[model samples]
Target chain A: MQTETDLVTGPAPHWHEGVSIIDAMQDVLLALIPITITGILIFGTGALLVIITCVTGAVLGEIVARRFKGEQTNLGDGTAVVTGLLLALTLPPTAWWAVVPLYTLGGFLSVAIFREAMGGLGRNRFNPALMGRVFLLFGRTTLVYLAPYLIDFNPAFTPWLEELEVVDVMAKATPLLRVVEGMELPSYSTLLAIYEGGSPAETSALAVILGIIYLIYRGRISWRIPITTVTGVFLLSLFLGQDPLFQVLSGGLLFGVGFMATDWVTRPVTDTGKIIYGLGIAVLVVFFRQFIAELWIGYGGVAFSILIMNGFVRYIDKLTARRVYGQKK
Target chain B: MAEKTFRGGIHLPYFKDLSSGKEIERVPVPEEIIIPLKQSIGAACEPTVKPGEKVEAGDIVGDSEEFVSAPLHTGLPGVVKAIEPRITGTGSKIKSVIIKVDKNFSAAKPDKARNAEEVSKEEIIKAVRKAGIVGMGGAAFPTPVKLTPPDDKKVDTVIINGCECEPFLTCDYRVMLEKPKELLQGSKFLMQTMEADKCFIAIEENKMKAVNNLRKHNTFSNIDVLALPSIYPQGSEKQLIQAILDREVPEGGLPFDVGVLVQNVGTTVAIYDAVIYDKPLTERVVTVTGPNINKPANLLTWIGSPVKNLLEKCGGIKNKPARVVMGGPMTGTALSELDAPIVKSSLGLVVMTVEDSSLDVDDFRPCVRCERCIKACPIGLYPNYLSMAMEENNVVEAEKWDAMSCIECGICSYVCMSKRPIVYLIKKAKEKIQENKSD
Candidate 1:
C-alpha cells in the first residue's frame, strides 16, 4: 500500500499499531453474545427483558449524569451499556422497572462518583460497574434490615404477586442459600445443568466456557486471571474437604471469573500482579460464600470477591511491578 | 536457523526486499554540497577552509583541536561557495561548508599502502583520524577515539555489527554482500588497533547470504561469523554484546566496560577505506526506498548530498511521500523539508506512504493498562507507568521507574495498543529531569 503522501511529519518510527478502547469494548460484547443467547434459552424471555431494560437504563443514566455535569454523553462508546449489561447479567430476574431503576441509579452514581469524580476513564482505581453494584447492595441491605422492609410492606404488590402464581419460588430460599443453611445440595447432574440456583449469567456453564475461549483466543482478555482465580477456589475447596467440582461449577463463580474479575481497568497488568490478584479474589469468594453465608449475610456472593479486591488492586500492582530491564539490583 | 537473541524485541516488516539484493548505484557527483562540521556526536568542528578556496575531494574543510571530534571532508572537487550555518537532514543547523562542484574533479592521492597486512596500530589510528572516520551506524562517534579505550579496561572481543535491524534500510546489508573482503580487512585493522584477539561478525538471520558471503571470504584464524537472532534492535550495541557474551554493560556504562568493542558494518568499511587505503570519509551507501518512490534502490551518495537528490535518482515521489524519514522507520527523524542534506552517518532516505506510516486515520486512545508496551519493550521498562508519571508531572516517580534508562527505541509506542505516545512521555520525562538538575 504505497501511495504518495503529504509531507507527513511526526514522531519517530512514524508508525502506530494498537487496538482502540472502543474495539476492545466491542470485543468484550462479542464474547458475551453466546452467553446472552444461552441465558435467553434457559430463563425464557425474562432474561432478555431484564438485560434490555438494564442496558437501556444505564445508557439513559450515563446521558443524564453527563448532562448534569455540562458534558456530552459518550453513549456511542458502549462503556455505559457494557456496565449496565454486566450488572443485569449477575442480578436475579426481577421486575424490569425494579432492576432497571436501581441499575440506573448505580450507573449514574458510578459514572459521577467513581469514574469522573476520581479521574477519567483510565485513571479510575475501581471498576465502575462492580463498585456501583456494591454501593447499591450495601445501601439496600441497610434499608432492608435497619428500616425493617418498609417498601416490601405494600399490600397491593403482594396480591399482584399472588395472581402471578410465583410466590412459592420467591418465599423459599434458593438451593445455594439452603446449602449454606446446612441443607442437602442438589445432585451433581442437576448442578451441571441449569436448574435455577445462580445468577442469570451463570445459567449455562457451557455457554460461559465458549465465551471465555473466544475472548482469550482473540487476545481481548488474558487467561491468567480467570484460570488462576478458579484454581484458588478449587484449592481451598480441596483443603476444606468439599467437592471441588461442585464448589467451582455451581454459583456464579464461572461467569464472574471468566468475565467480571478479569475487567482490564480493575485488575493488574503485570503477570505476577494478575496471578496474585486472581488468587486473592478466589480466597475471598470462598470465604464469603462458605463461611459468611452461614450467618445469612446476603449482601455479596461471587461479586463480593471482586468488590473487595478493588481496594487492593493498586497496592498489588505497585508491589508486583517487574524490575525494569537492565535495572541493577 | 535463528542465532543468539536477547529478551524483549519486536519483529518488523523489513522491506529490504526493495533493495537488499540490489547493488549500490554510484550517484553522479552533485552540483552542490552542504557538509556540516558538527555532524559527529562530539564537540563541533571549526571551519578550516576559507570561502572561495578551491579544494579537491577528500580534503579537510572543518576540524577542531578537540580530541573527541572527527574532521569534515569535501566530497567533490569544488570551489567553496559559502561558509555558513545550514540545515542537515537530522534537523540541526550547524556551521557548514557549501561547495559548488568543479566540472573537472580530481580525488586526493593516497600515500598509505592498500595491503591491510602492512598497516601497524599507530598507522591505522593516524590514517583513521586524518580521514575523519566516524561511526557510520548513525551514531557518528569518532572511530579513532573508540579504538583507544581507557588503559585500565581490558578489551578482548571486537564485534562487527552486521545486524542492520532497522527496517527498510539495507545499506549495511549491501555493504556486507558487496564488500565482504573489505569488511574483513577492516576488522583486522580494528583488532590490530584495539589489541583485541577475537573477532565476531554478527549478522542477523535474515541476511543468511551475507553471513555465508562473510564466512566464505574470512581468512582470519580468530574470526567467526554468526547469524544473530532476527529481531529489531539486535544491532543495538549493548543488546548485541549481551547476546553474544551474556555480559551486561553496567548501568550508565559503555561496551568497553564489559571488555568488548563494538562497531557497525558500515563503520568497518569506512575504517577499511581509511586504514588499508588513505581514503578520507566522504561518500556512504544510503538506502532510498519505500512504496511511495518510483524506484526503490541503494545509492552511493556523497556526503552533504541533498536527500531529495537521492530520492529523485531512485524515482521521485510516486504520488506524494506519506512520510520522508531521515533514517530507519523505527528510530529515524521525520523529514519535512525533502531538500535537507545527508551528513556523515545518514543511513537511509525512507520515502514511506501514508499507508506505511499509518497516521491521521486514528486518534490516540487512553491506556487500558493492557501491559502490551511492557511486553514489547526490549529494555523491560514499564512504559505504562513512565507515561503516567510524565502526565502527572511527577519527575520523581519517573526516576523511580527508570526514565533515564529508556533507549528511545520507539518500540513502546509502536506496540502500544492505546497508541499512547509512550516514547514522547519518556522524552519529556528526561527533559524534566535535566531541567530539575539545572535548576
Candidate 2:
C-alpha cells in the first residue's frame, strides 16, 4: 500500500553482501587474538601493559584528531584498535618501562599524524602502525641519550627500569640477530613453540600461523601477500646460505607479513601487485637483516621492508594493472 | 561435462525460492493499459492509431519506419482513451497509448499453426519484426535488429542465455520449465535465421530442472544444453559468450565481432510464438515476487499492465516495501511509483522489505582499498581506480582506467565493504566521458 512517494529509491543492487568496514575490521581484531594471548602468556604482565597502553593511546589519539578536524569520530570501526595492537606486537617486551610512554607515543603518532592527518583510515599512504614503529626506531638514539638524564630527574623511574632489566634475561638477541652474529640457533620445534628473543608477538611462530589461518578462513586477508612473503623469505634465505627455517621463523617476519605488510589500505590492491609487493618486502627484509643487523642491535628489518614496499604500492598497482576483459594483451 | 563460468563474478544469494517453484498463471485483464511507444533501445514508434480509435487485440497500435525499432501491439481489444506521456518502469515518461480495455472482449485464437520447418530465413525475420518481438531478458533490443547482424560480421554461433543469474527472479526458469519444446524450437528458428552452425542453450546449474527438461526435449544434434556455474551476471551477453566460447567480444564491439549472438531464452520463446503461432508479442512471463509479496508468483502478464495491478494480483503487498525493483535485483530499475506500466524489458517485480534491502545509501565510508570490487568485476576493469577517478570527476582519468568497459553489473557495489555506489559513479563518469567526446 506504500506509494512511491513514501519509499526510498537507490541505484541498482538494493542488496549488499552484508560485510561492512566495521565487520572486516572486527574480523581482523578477532584474527589478532591468538598472537595477543600468546604474547601475553610468554612475556607476562609487561606485554599486557604495552598492549593496554598502546590501544588506549591510539583510541584517544583518534578521537582527538577527529575532534580537531571537525569530523565525526569512527572509533567503533575498530581500525585504531587494530593499529594499536599491531604497533604493540612489533615492540620489544623487555624494553624499559619508559617504553610504555614511548609505545603510547607511537600509537598516538599512528592514528593522529600518520593516519588522520594524512586523510584518515584508507587514505593513509603508509601503514600507520609501521610508520609509528619506524618513528620509534628513528628516535631510539634520542631515547638512549636521554635515558640517564630521565632516570636522574625521576627516582621513581629507577625501579621500573631495574625491573625491566630482570625481565631482559628472557629477551636476548633474536634468532636472526644471532644468525648475523654466527651463534647457535634454537631447534625448529622450540622456535615454533615459544622462542623468546625478538618482539613480543614473535615469541610463538605457532601463534602467528594460527592467526594467519583464522584471517584466511575469515576472508579478511588474501593469501598472495602472506604466502608469497614467506616463500620469498625462505627462498632468499636458502640463496644466502642461511637456515631457511630460521629465517622464516625468526624476528617479526611471520607476524609482520600476516598483519602489518598485508594492511588493506597500505598494500597494493591487485593480486599480481600484492605478489610483487610481498616479494619486494621479503627481499628488503633479508637484505637488511643480513647486512644491517650488525650495525643496529634489534634491527626491525620486517617493519623497514614493509614500509619501503608501502611506498611502492601505487607504482605496483599501476604496473600490475589487470588487462581489461576483451582488450588486446 | 564440467560446468562453465567466466572469471570475476560474485556468488549472490539467489532468493529464487520466493517464486521459483510457483507455476505460471495468467493475470486477469485490467480495465486500462498504457503501452509505451518505445520499449527497446532504439527509436520510439509513432502512434499509428489516433485517440478514440478502436483497436483489436494483437493490432499494431504504434509503428515506426526505423529498421532498428519494433511495432507495439495492444493485448486486449480496447478503445484508445488518449496518447499521452506516461511513466514506465525505467522511470522515463514517454508518449504512451492508453487504452480502456473492453471487459467482455476476448482474443480470437489463431487459425492454424504454421509449419516452422518450411519457413525460410527471410520469412522468419520478417515475421519476427512484424510480431514486434524484442529481447525479453530485459535489454529489449529489437530482435529483428539483433537477428540482422552486419553483413561484414559472421555470427556462427547462437547462445540462448538461460542463466538467469539475477537473484530473486525466476521467470526465465519457469518459462524454460513450462515451455521447453517451444524454447528449443525457437532457438532452432533463431539458428536458422542467423545462419549459425551450432547453438548452445546455456543454463546455470542452479536451474538444473529446466536444464534437464530442455536437454530431454532437445531434438537437434547441433544444439547442446550447457549447465554453467551459478554466478551473478553469468547471464550477461558478453560474459556468456566468454564462458561458453572462450572468446572475448572485442572491446567496444558487439557479440557479432566474436562470431557469436546471445539471445535470452524468453526472447527465443517469443520468437517461436511469432514464427509458429503467427502471433505478435502481447504478453510475457513476469516473476511477481519478493519478501513483501504475500503470494509470490510467476504471472503471465500483458505488456502494458500497471505494476500495481500485478502486485495486487499476487495477493498484494504484505508490508510496505523498501524497494520495488523491476527486473533482477542486480541490474533492475527501482520503480519510483506503482503507476509505471510494465514495458517489454521488465523481467519481474521484486518488492524488497527493509531486511532484504539493507543498503544505507547515505552512509558511505572511505574506500578501504580492499580490491573486492576489482576481483568481482566481470569485465576485469579496475573498479577501485575507476571509482577514484569518477569521484574526482576526472573524465580523462576515468577513460584511462577504461570506465567505458564497465558492464554496470553492480557486483562492484554489492561486494564493496565501504558500500560505495561504485557502478553509479562509473555510469556518471561514462556519461560525462561521452559528453566530452561529443563536445
Candidate 3:
C-alpha cells in the first residue's frame, strides 16, 4: 500500500524573480561588447587572438581547478569569460602574440590559485583577471624579456590593420609611453579617436564611455567608483600642475575605473565605502606613476593599486556599515 | 497627498489588480466545520461544550483563563461532532472542535447593529476579551492583550494599518471601501480604551480610493487618513510606527515601547462588532487569489472554512496549485495540504501554480555581495553578513551584526539577485540566539 504524502511545504516567500549569479555575470559580459569590438578594430587580429586564448584558458582553468578541489563548478555562468576578457583588455596590445602564453599561464594561476582556492567567484579576495595581469607584469622577467619581441614585429598577418588609415599609430613605445618620456602629448579631443594608444581597449576612450553608459542605464554597475575615482585623479593631476585631461583619458585609468573597481565581490559594497575605495585607487595610481616611478615599471601602478585595495575591502565594509536603525553607538 | 515612507525598501510588482476590482464573495457555512480552540497568541482554551451537546451561533464553545488568550465562539448552530486534533493552515496539528451543522442550520448574524458612542472604555475592553478578537493582520495576538500595555509606559498614539502591502491580497482594501464607518468608529473605541492622544489610518498610495473613502468620514476629527508608499512590509507594525511617528521602536522591542499601538482594519471591524453588538469573533474576510486560481476574489469566509472549500467557491483552480499560502506572499505560511482550515489570523488564501514549487535549489549561489539586500531591508539590518555568519555557524558574529534586529519581513530574500535565502538565515540565527538565552 502507498501513502498519500507528496505535498510541498516551504518557507514564507514563495516567489523569486529569474536572476542568478550567471545572469549578473552575463550582464557584465554584455556590457563589455563595445570595448571588445573597439580593441579588435584598433589592433586587428592580434586583439582577437589575445581575447580568445585568454578566455579559453581561464574557463578551462576554472573547470580543472574546481574538479580537482572536489567542488561544484558551473561553467556556463560567464564569470570565467568576464575574467578572461578583462585580463586581455588591460594588457598592452603589442603583447598580442608574445604575451599570449604568459598571460594564459597567468589566467590559469588566476582561476587555480587566486579564485578557486580562495573560494570561487563572490568569495574570492582579488579580482581574478586583475590578479592574473599583475602576476604576468611582476612575477618574472616575462614583460622584460618579451618587450623587444613586440617592438621589431611586422603587421603582416594583420590583414585588417593594413586597411585602416591610422596603421602608423599601432607601434611599440605607445602614445602614453611617449608622454612618460616627456614627448609632446596629443590634443585632448584626439583621445576619443583610434590613433590614441595604450592597451587595445584603452585605444578608444569613447568606446569605454559608451560601455559605461550601458552599465549605468541598466543599473547593473555602481556609478560612485568611476565618477569619483576618475575625478579624484584628474583633480590631483591639476594640483600637481600637470595636464588633467591627459591624466583622465590616457592610460588604463578609464578602463580600470569604469569596470575593475566596481566588481561587487572585491570592492567595498557600501555606498560611502565605494567612494572611499575609488578615491584610494585614484591616489595610488596617480601617486605611483607621477611621484614614485615612471616609464614601463609604473604603467602597472593601476592594477597594483586595485589588488592592494581589495585586501582592505572588509575593513572598508565594517567602517562604512549602516547603523542599525535604533541601536546605541 | 504625498506618500509617507521610511528608507530601505523594495518596490515589487503589486499584483493587486488581480482581485482588487472583485467584491468580496461569501462562503456559505459548510456541512462540517473544523474550529481550532487555540485561535489567538496565548494559552489553549479549555473545552466548554462536550461531544453529543447541541450548540448554536454566538454560543461560547471554549474559554481559557489565561490573560494572553481569547475565548472561542461557535459561528454555526450545530451538534458537536467531536473535539479532537485537526490540521491548521500552518501545517501544524492542533486540538479543534469538529461540528456538524443542524438540518435547519442558520449561521451567525454578522449584521447586528452597533452604537459606537454608547460603548465605554471598560465595557469595550471586557467585550473584546469576551468576543475573542485576535489581530487579523496575521500575527493573531489577542486584541485585549495588545490593548493592555504597561502602566509606566504611556500609550499616546493609535495607528490603523490599512496598508495591505502584500501582493495578491486585497481583502483589507475592499473592507476599507465597503465599511469605512466601522473602521473609524472601531478605531475611536480603541483610542478611547487606550487613552491615546491621536489616531492615524495609514493606507498605501496604491489604495488611494480607500484613503479617500476613509478621509470622507469626517465625523472623527482625531482620526487622520494618511497615505504611505506602496512597498513590501510597509504595513509592518514597526515600519508603520516608524514612518508616521518618526520614532524607532528600539532593537528587539515592540511598537508599544515607542508609545504607539497598531491594529489591522479587519480587526478593527471585529472590535466594533464585539464592543457595540456584544458579538464574538467567528468570521473574517480572507482574500482568495492567484494566477492559478480560476476566479480570484476577496472572500468573506467563516473562520473554520477549509481552504479547499474557499478555492472551490472561487471556481477552483486553472491548474495544479503547487502551494497554498495562508496570508500574503511576502510573509504567508505555505501549506502542505488544502484540507487545513482557515483560522482567525488567516488573512488570505493564495493558490499559486506548480511553478512556485518547481524552483530549483541548484540556482542558489554564493552571496554576490550586492547591497540589494541592504537596500531592501526595512529594519536596516545587514542581512548578507547575517547570512555569512550563519553560513559559518558563528552565532556571536551574527548577533554583533544585529541579526536579532531583523523583522523577518522576507524583503531581503525577495530582492536578492543571487536567490539567497537571507531571511531564512536570519530566522535561524534569531532562533539560535533565543535558544542560547534560555539555556
Docking level of model 3: medium
Could you give the fnat of all candidates in order?
0.67, 0.71, 0.60
Residue-by-residue lDDT tens digits, candidate 2, A55-150: 887998899999999888988888899899988887776445667787788899899999999878788889999888888766665766766564
Candidate achieving the largest lDDT: 2
> What TM-score quantifies how close candidate 1 is to the native fold?
0.91
Docking class of 2: medium
Alpha-carbon interface RMSD of model 2? 1.7
Q: Give the TM-score of chain A in candidate 3.
A: 0.87
Quote the RMSD, in angstroms, for model 1: 3.6
Please, what are the lDDT tens digits per residue for candidate 3 over residues B1-439?
4456776887778889999999877886687778888888889898899999998888888889889988887777889999999988767898998888774865445576656767788899999988998999989899998888888777899999999988888999999999998899899998999899799999999999999998988488888998888877899888888789888888777778889999999999999888878888888998989877888888888778788888888887676535778888778887877778888999898877767643333346778787778878888877888887787889999988888888888888877777777787788899999999999
TM-score of 3: 0.92
TM-score order of candidates, top first: 2, 3, 1
Q: Which candidate tops DockQ?
A: 2
Tell me candidate 2's fraction of native contacts, as a decimal between 0 and 1. Answer: 0.71
Ordering by lDDT = 2, 3, 1
Q: Each candidate's root-mean-square deviation in Å?
A: 3.6, 2.3, 3.3
lDDT of 2 by residue, B252-322 (tens): 99898999989998899999998988899999999998787789999998999999899889888777646
Error of 2 at B62 (Å): 1.9
